[model samples]
Target: MGPIIGMSPDKKAETPGKQEERVGLRGVSGGPGTLPEAEYGAASPLATSLDRGSGGSEDEELTNLNWLHENLLQNFTLGGAQPSASPLFDIEGDPGGPLNASLSSSSQRDSLKSKPPLSFSLLIYMAIEQSPSKSLPVKDIYGWILQHFPYFSSAPTGWKNSVRHNLSLNKCFRKVERSLGKVNGKGSLWCVDPEYRPNLIQALKKQHLPAAHAFCTPPASPPRASSPPRHLFLQGCSLQESDIDAATAMMLLNSAPGHHHANPCDPDSPLDLSRPDSVLVSSDPKQDHNYSSMALQRCSSRSSSSSLSSLDEGGPSPGHTRSRTRPRRAGSEGFHSDEDSDLGDDRARPQPSQHRSSPLSSSVKRPVGKRARREVTAKPELDEELKEAAGSLLHLAGIRTSMELNKHSAKSKKLNRK
Candidate 1:
C-alpha cells in the first residue's frame, strides 16, 4: 500500500484508483505549527502534531505566500516584478478600481458609519479558509479575498484598522492563539481555522454583493493542474483522525520530548499520527513524562489557549458558527447567545501558532504540587493540590474535585474523585 501519513515510506505499493494529492490551504490549523482539537470537530492535540494546512510537500508553492502577498500589495505601486511573465494576476478583472457600487449616498452608509467599516466577513473568512496574511500570522484568507475582489481599495481610509478590530472581537479568532511577534512596532500574532469560519462562500454570496464577491474569490495561482474549487481545504475526516489508537497514541507520546514536546507540524505534509505504521518509536519513558507535564502546565496557564489543540474535535459546524454571529440589523431572527444556544464557546476552535515549539507530553508524570496534596491525597500530602488536580484532570472532573475533598487517600481517590 502507498504510504499514509505518519507511516514509513513505501518502496512497494498497491492501490485501486489513482491516488489524488490532498488539497490543503497553507495555514488551515493556524499557521506553521498547530494542533486540531477534538471537542468541537478537531482531532485531539495528543494524537499527532497536526499542521494547519492540507497535505502537500514541505516545499510546495503555497508553503509561505508571505513574499507573494507583500510584493503584490506594497510593490504594486512601485511596478515591481520578479522578471516573471506575470507578477500579480489581474485580480477580479477589475480594470477600473476594486470596490463596486458604494453605499456612499444612501442611509446605509450613514448607518454603517457607526459600525466600523471593518469587514467581519473577511476576518471570518480567514478563519474558515485557514489562509494567512502576508506575515504568515494565521495567514488570513482576507488577502486572497482582497486579491479576488480588489474592489475594497476605494472603500475608505480607516478600513484597515476597522478590519483588524473586527477580527479581535471574533471569538473564534481569539480562541485560536498565534505567536506573539511585533509587526511595524505593534503586536502581530494571530491564528485561525478556515473550516470553522461562519458561513461558506456560496452562503455569503447569497447575502451581500460585497460579501459574496469576497467569499467567491479563489486562489490567484496560474492553473498548472486541472481541479475544481481550486482553493485548498483542510478537512476533518473520521477515518483519518480516528485511526490513532491507543498503541499508536503511546508511540506519539514516546517520540515527544519528556519535558518539552515539539511536533514538526507541516500542514503541507501528511499528519504524522494519522498514519502510524511508519512511526519510529523513540519515546523515552523517563523524559517523555517530564516533558509533557511541563508543557501541560504551560498550556493550562494560558487562558486564551483553551482550544489550542482541539479544532478537529470542534468540527466544522459552519451553520452553528454562522448562527453564533448574529446579525446586528433589526428583524434578523438568527441565533442569539444563551445557555441553550449552540453558539456558545463550543463553536470556538483552538488557536494556532507560527510554529509548534513545545508541547509537554500528556503521558508524563508530574511532580505532585504541595497544594494538590494537602487538598486531597494522603501519602502524597506534601503535594496534595497537584495530586488532586492531576487526578481530577485525569478523571475529567474540574479542579473542584481536588479542592473539595475533605479526606485524602489513594484508596478513596477513584470513588471520591469520580
Candidate 2:
C-alpha cells in the first residue's frame, strides 16, 4: 500500500526509524512505533514519547529528555508523586473556580483564627443574654460556647470546670430557679443580674463583634422633666438692697452688747477673772478694797488648814514637847512622898509652844532615809485606834524602865548592908 490514508510519506518513512531509535535508547523490547513501559513509568507513554520526538537537535533533546525521563520513572515507580486533589485543572474553561473557592475558604479560616477568644465572664454574659427567657442552665451555657467557638471543641475538658467556676463566683451572674412545671434540669438556670446587664452589654459592644449588637439592646429610660433655670429661681427669691440693709440694722439692734474685756468663764482668758478681786464689776474704790480683804481672808483660812494637815503628818515639830506624868516609886514609904514632889516639879516646868514649821522649812529639814521619806509623805489623817495603841506602848516602856531602876536600887542596898 502506497502511504497510509492519514500519514504523509515522510512521516510514514520516519516513524519506523524513530521507533527503532526509542527502543534502542530505552533498551526495551517493543514493536515499531510502540512506546516502552520503562521510559514513562505510570505516565502516558504515548504522550511522553510524542513530546520527546517533536523538537530540537537529536543529541540535545535526547540528553534533556533522558534526564527528565529518569527522574519521572523514579518518582512514579516509587509512588512519591501525588496528583492534585482539586478538580479545577480538569475542567475546561473554569480554572479559577476551585482557586477562588480555596482562597475564600482560607480567608474565612484566617478571620476566625484572628479573633481572640472571649473572656469567661463575657462568654457567660453572652450566653445568658441570648437565651430565650434571658436565662440558661449551666449545661446549656457550656453547649453554647462549644457551638459558637470552634477552638473550645478540641480544647481540654477542664474548660467546662472553668465555666462553672465563673458562673458561681461572678457577682454579675444570678441563679434563677425554674418553675415547678418548667424544671427539666437538676441545677437552677443562670441569668445576668439586671443591675449589671448594662455594664455587660457595654463591655460586649467594645469587643466590636456584630453578633454582640443583636443581644445588647438595653431598655429605654423614662423622659425626665426639665428643671427651671437656677438664675431665675434665685432672682425670684432674692432680697432687695434696701430690705437687706434694714434687716442688717435690725439684727444689730436686737443683739446683746459685747464685753470689751475677757469673759471670766472663758478658759482661754490669761488672768484669773473668776476671783472677785480680779473681776472689777463696779468702778468704786471702797468695793474693790472690800473684795481684796475677803480674798485675803479666804487665803488665810486655806493656809491654816494646810498647816494643820502638815503638822498631823509629821507629828509635833522639834520646837514642841509632849507632857507626861512621872511613874510612882516602888517598895518605899518615901516613894509616895517623892511621887507628889515629882508631879509638882513636872507641872512647874514651862511647856514648849505648839508651833508648826512652814511646809518649805519642814521639807528642807526632812531626813533622806526610806522610812523617814515614807512618814513625811504619809496621809495627814491619823486613825484614833492607832493613836491609842502608840500611847499604850509609851506607857508600858516607862513602867519597865522604872522597874529596872527599882531592882538596881535593891542590889545597891544589899551591897551597903554587906
Candidate 3:
C-alpha cells in the first residue's frame, strides 16, 4: 500500500492515551480532528467532562463514558433498536421504577374500560336502599348515582333515560303514593320490593365488584316504627244512660274547656268538630228512652222535696260560682259537688236541680251572650271537657270513670287557686 496521506515516514504510531486526548479535544472544539459520525457516533458528555480534567481517576472516567453510551443508545434508539446490555438499565431489577408505574396505570385503565359498569337496576337499588326512607324519586335517584359514581358525571344523557326505563320496567322496584300533604314534587317514591330484595342482594354478590359486599349486607338497624296515634280525649266514653242526640253530644264536647286540637295530618286524630255529621253515635233509641225515663223517675221520686229546698237556698256560693267558669277536663264528667273538688279549701254548696239536669233531657234553655260564650270557649280546659264528654257519650257508653280524671281535676283546681 502507498504511504498514508498526511503521515511522515519518520512519524511513529500514536498511543491509546494520546488518541483519546485528541478525540476529546476535537469534540470540545468541533475542529477538523473530529472523527466521522460513523466511527464514534454523537458527541459524548463523558468526553467533555474528561477534557475539563474533572477530579476522577482514568478508570472512573472510562466507566462513566460507558454509562453515558448505554443511556444514549437505550433512550434515543429507533424502532427495533436492541436494548442496552448494561445491568443499570435493566427494568426487571427495579420493580418501583417510573416505567413500571406507567405500565401499571395504563393496564388499570384498560381493565376498567373492558369491565362492564354496574347495571341500572343495581344502581337504582343502591340509591333507594341507602335513602333514609328506603325510597327515592327519579330525580333524586339520578343525583345519588352521579354523586357516588364519578363515571356518570361525564356520561351521556342516555343514561338518565335508561335509569327511568329501568325503574319503570323492573319488577324489583315499586311505586308508592306520595303522602297527601307532602310538597315534594309530583314524582312518586320508588322503593325496592321486599320479596325481591334477597334476590337482588344475591345478584350483587355474584358481581364480585369491589366494596359491593357492603350493599349485599342488610342494614345494621331495623326500620323505624311509625309514631303511635294520639288517643282522643273521649275515646273511653260510652254513655248508655240517656237518649242523647249526636248533635247535642258534639255540642257538649265542643263547649268543654281546655281542649287540645289534634294534629290535622294525623290519620287517627279525634272527630273533626267542624263536621258533626261524621260523629258516630252508638246509643240505641229504645234503650236511651228507657234509661232517661228511669233516671227522671229516680230523680223526681228521691229528690223532689230536697230539690225544692236546695233551690230556695239560692244556688252555690260565690266562690263555687267561679268553679263552673274554671276550665274542666274530660275526666270531670263524673265530677260531683259532694265529691272532693280539686280545691281542697272549697266547700260544696247547694245548686238547683235544673242546673244539674242532663243537657239531653233539660227543657230549660240558658241563653249565653257572645262575649260570655267566647270567654268560656276561650278557656283551653273547658274545650278539653267538652271533647271528653262528647267522646264518652258517643263512643264509650257505660265505661267507668278513671281515677286519673279525678287527679287531673284536682290539679286544675290547685292551679286555679295559684
Candidate 4:
C-alpha cells in the first residue's frame, strides 16, 4: 500500500521476501463508497512493474498489462470524447474481497473490442518505451519483459537468440555496438548516445509503428565533445602501434547512428548503436565481470586504454577521461538473451544453443569460490596447439551437414572445457 521498505521509485526495485499477503491492485466489487483515493490515483507495485519491459515473447503478457496501465493513466487529448473526464487511472481502488472475475473479464473484453488485437509493432514500441533510460542490458531486457509480460512463464528455447537476431536485422528495431566510456574518471557506464532514441523511433515508426511518430521526441542534453575517440575497438584488449589506425578502421567499420533520422541499415549506413547502448556497463567491477566483458565486446573496438595506462602513448589526452560517456551496447547472446544477428532485426533462433560459458562458470571443476577467478597466461605452444586443433576441427567439419548443430555442439564443448 505504501512504499516498500528500502525501495525507492528511482532506483532498481528490490523485491522483499514473499509475505503471506502481497499488496497489489484488485478490480472493484463494491460501489463508490468502498474506495480510498478512488478520485485521485492509486500507485501500486503492479503498476510500476508494468512500466519496465524490453520485449520478447516472455514480455507479451506482463508487458501488455503495463501498456494497459499506461493507457489508463494517459487521457486522450481534449478534443477526444469527454473534455474533463478522469483518465482510467482513477478507477483503481481496494476491493474488500476478490475482484468480480466476470466483471474483470468483461472489462478486458470491452477494452480489447475497443481496439484492434495487439500487433507486433505496437508490442515493440511499448517495449522500447519501457526500456531503461540508461539503455538496457539485453539480458535484463528479458527479465524486465517477463516482469511486465507474464506470458513467458516458460521462455521458448533460444528465444533470446531469436530476439537478438530480429533486433539486429529487423527494419523496425535499431541495434548497434557501443563502448563503455569512462564515468567520472573512476568507472564507466552505458550512456545513451545522442540521436539513438530518435533514430530508433523514426525507424520503427516508418515501418512497424507508424502511429508512434506522434510521440517520438528526445530530451535535450548539454553539448558533448565533438572530437572523435582515437581507439577503434575494445579499449583494453588489443592496443598496439599497428592498431593505431583503429580509429580509421572504426570509422570504416562504424558510422553515425542517427544520421538518416531513419532506421535503415545499409553497408553505407552508420553502425546501429542500439546493441551498444544495451551493452553499456556500470563502473563497479565488483558487481560482475561478465557484464563488463559483454559490454566491452559489444563495442568490440580497439582503444588506447592500455597505451595510456602503461604510458605506451607518448602522452595521454590533454582532457580528463573521467567524464561520463554514453551507453555502450546491447547483448543478448546467452540463453536468456537473443542471438547475435549482425545483419537483421530479431529472427527466430533455432534452439537453446549453449554458448561458451565464462571461465568463472567452472575452472578445474569449481573455480568460483570466495576469491575471484584468475585468467592464467597461456603458453605460446599451448595457444598455438589450441589454434591448430580448432583449425583442424574446422577443416574436417568444413561443410557440415548441419551448421547450426555443429556450432552448438562446438560451443557446448568449449563451455564444458571451461
Candidate 5:
C-alpha cells in the first residue's frame, strides 16, 4: 500500500466521468449550491432565453445577470429567509418557495374570481355615488354599471336582477319615492346612505382599482353646439335715426305755415333747418277752387238776383267798395217777419196796401267771410236748357207765392167774422 504513482491515495480516484454525472445530478435535483433550469425559466423568462443562446460573450452574460439581480431584488422579496444567497443563481436559498407558490396560486384563484363579484347593495351604492344627481333609480343603477364598468356591459341578464335584489335587501342603500311632481314620474329614486359613503368608497376602491380610474370624471358633455341667436326673426332690414329724422323733416316742411309758428328747426321741434324748403308747397289749387265754389253756392242761394246781377255787370272797384260785403236778410239779424207776427186788432180795420214782404227782401250788408281783393270771378256757364229750367222754376215760385197770399187773406176774413 505504498502510494500508487498515477493517483492520490484519498479514496478511489475521483473519475472525471463520475464527477460530470454528479454535477448533472445536482443540476436536475436543484442541489443546495445550484438553481434548477425549470425554476430559472419560470422566474425570469429573459434569463431562460439568454441561457438558451450557446454563443453569448462572457461580458454580455455578466451584464444581463447584473441587470436581472438589481431589478428583481428591488421588486421581489426573497421571503425564503436567506440573506446572502445570489438573487439570480441560488435555489435552496428559497426554503419557503413552495409556500410562496401556494400563496401566489391562491391569489391567482382570487383574481380569477368574477370581477370582485359586485354585491347588489355595493353596486347600487357605487352607482349613486357616481351619478350626477348622487341619486338614481334602481333601473338607472343597472344602466350605470353597463356604462362605466365594461364588465357588466356584456354580462348576463342575471346581474340586473341581482342589483334589484340587493337594493331591496340592503339597509345601507335607501329608496326614495320620487316626488309626485317630478317630470320623470314612473320609478322610485335610489340613494346611498350618506353615512355609508365612506365604506362604500373604500370597498369600491378595494374591488376595482385606483380611485382615479374607478371613479372617472364623466366625459365632458360635448360642448353644446353654440345655439344661433334667439332673436334672429328679422332679416337684414334695420331702422336708423337718420331715416326717422328725414321723414319727420318732410312732415314738418309739408305742414301749414300757421303750424310752423313753433319754428320746426328749433331744438324742441322734430324738423331741422338742414332739411330743404322745396318739400313744402302752397295749398293745392284744386282744393282752393273747390272751397271757393262751395262758398259761392251758399252766398248765391241766399242773395237776390238783383245784387248778383249788379256784381256781374261791373265788378266793384276796390277803392269804392272798400267795405265789400255779403248781403244779409233783415230777419236773419234777430228780426222776425210780419208773417210770423200774431194778428193785431188794427188788422180788423182795413190797413194800407202794405203787403207783408218776406224777410229776404229787406237785406243789410255784412262783410264777406274771406277778403281777397280780387274781382268777382266769372260764374260757371249754364247750358241753354238749364237756363230755361231756371226760368220755369222762378215762374212756378211766383204763382205759389200768390196762392199762399190768397189763402192767408181768406183765413184772415174768417177770423174777422168770428
Candidate 6:
C-alpha cells in the first residue's frame, strides 16, 4: 500500500466548511480534528498533564449536571437537555462547554453550601419570637430574615417567593385577620402555632451557629428569687390592677372610645363596657365599700321623696301613703332578685338632688321619669290645648254673626212696610 489516502476528495474541496463544522461541534459528538500522531510525534509530558486535567474537569462538570438533573429536576431526562430547567443547564448554547458548565456548577455548589439547609419554618419562628409583640406579618418576616441571616441577604432572587410559599404551605404558622379598625394595606397578623413553638425552640438551640458562642453563653450566676413583685405606673399615678382578663384588656387597648367592641352578638347592641359618659366603679376594696354605702343612703332619700311627690300629685288617701312609705323587709339579704328589684325602683325614680351630687352625672344624662318625660316633650298636650282654643274662638264668632243677622233682618222688614 503506497500511502493510505486519509482526506476524502469531497472533504478537501470544502476544507473551510469542514473546519467550521468541526469547531462548532468540538465539545459534543467528538473533539477538534488533530494532526496525525506520526507527524506530530508523541505529546510532551507537560502538555499531556494539562490535557488530562482539562478532560478531568469536563467529566466532573458532566457528573454534577447529571446529579442536579436527578435531584432538582427529576422529570427532566439528561438525553433531551430541556431548556426549561435552565438552573441546571443552558441547553441553547454550548450545553457541555467548560465556560457555561463550570459557571453553573460552581454557582450551584456555592448556593448549596451558602444556604445551611436550615428549616424555613424555624427561621420564621425565630423572627416572630424575637419580635416585640411575638408576632409578625409576611413582609416583616422577609425583612427579619434578610436582616438577621447574611446568607439570605446575599442570596439571589426568588427567596421571597420561597418564603411566601413556605408560609402558605406550612401548618406551623397561623394567619389571623386584622381587626376592622386597622388601617387599609396593613396585612393580617402571623402567629407561631403554640404546638409548634417548642419544636422550633429546640431546633434553634440545636442549630450549629458560629456566633452562638460569642453571644448566647449561659449566665455565670442564677437570677435572684427574692425580688419583690413590681408594679406599673404612668407619670406617677399607679395603674390599677385590672379586673378584666387578657383578651378583654387587648380589646380595650385596640379600641377607641365610643366604638363598639371587637366581638358582639348583634350590630346594634355593642359590647362596650367602659363608656365615656359612664361612671366606672372604683376597683379598690375600701373605696368600693364607701361608694356603696353612699349610694344606699342616696337611694333611700330618693325613694322617700318619690313617695311624697306621688302623694301630692293626686292627694292619695293616708293608707296609700302609708303603704308607699313601708320600708323593705330586712330578711331578704341572700337573694339577688329581691334586692335587685327593690333597688331598681329607687333607681328608676328621678331625683334632682342625687343627679346634682354626682360630678360625672353632669356629663351623663340622667333618665327622666315617665310623667316628667312627657311634660318635657309636651307635643300631645300642646296640640290638644290649641284645638280647644280654636273651638271656643269659632263658637264666639258664630254668636256674633247671629246677632248681626237678626238686627239687619229687622231693619230690612221695617223699610219694606214703609
- Candidate 6 achieves a global lDDT of 0.30
lDDT of each: 0.24, 0.30, 0.32, 0.25, 0.29, 0.30
Q: Clash pairs of candidate 6? A: none
Q: Which parts of model 3 are misplaced by more than 4 Å?
A: 1-116, 180-182, 209-418
Q: Cα RMSD to native, each candidate? A: 24.7, 59.9, 43.4, 25.5, 59.1, 42.0
Q: For candidate 1, give the lDDT of residue 15.
A: 20
Compared with the true structure, what per-residue lDDT tens digits does model 2 show for residues 131-223? Answer: 434466787777655433333444456668978877654534656645521366567677664333323332332222221111122115321
Q: Give the per-residue lDDT digits (tens) of candidate 4, residues 268-328.
A: 2222222222112223222221222222222212222322211111111223121112112
Compared with the true structure, what per-residue lDDT tens digits does model 5 show for residues 181-254? 12475666665533233233223222222111211222244211121011100000111122212222222222
For the record, the alpha-carbon RMSD of candidate 2 to the native fold, in angstroms, is 59.9
For model 4 the local lDDT of residue 74 reads 24
Candidate 6 segments whose C-alpha is farther than 4 A from its true place: 1-113, 180-186, 208-418
Identify the leading candidate in terms of lDDT: 3
Model 3, 1-418: lDDT tens digits are 0121122111322122222222221122221211122212332211121122223333222222222222222222111022222111221222223322221232222211111133567668656654434567787777655443323443456668978877654545656556632246867667664323323432332222111112123236431212110111110111112212322343223222322222111112222333232222212222221212122222222333333311011112113333344333211221122112333433234444554345531111211121132232233444454465566554432122223234434765898899
Clashes of each: 65, 0, 23, 49, 0, 0
Q: Which consecutive 10 residues in model 6 have the weakest lDDT in total?
A: 228-237
Candidate number that wins on lDDT, 4 or 6: 6
Estimate candidate 3's alpha-carbon lDDT, on a 0 to 1 scale.
0.32
Error of 6 at 145 (Å): 0.7
**TM-score of predicted model 3?**
0.25
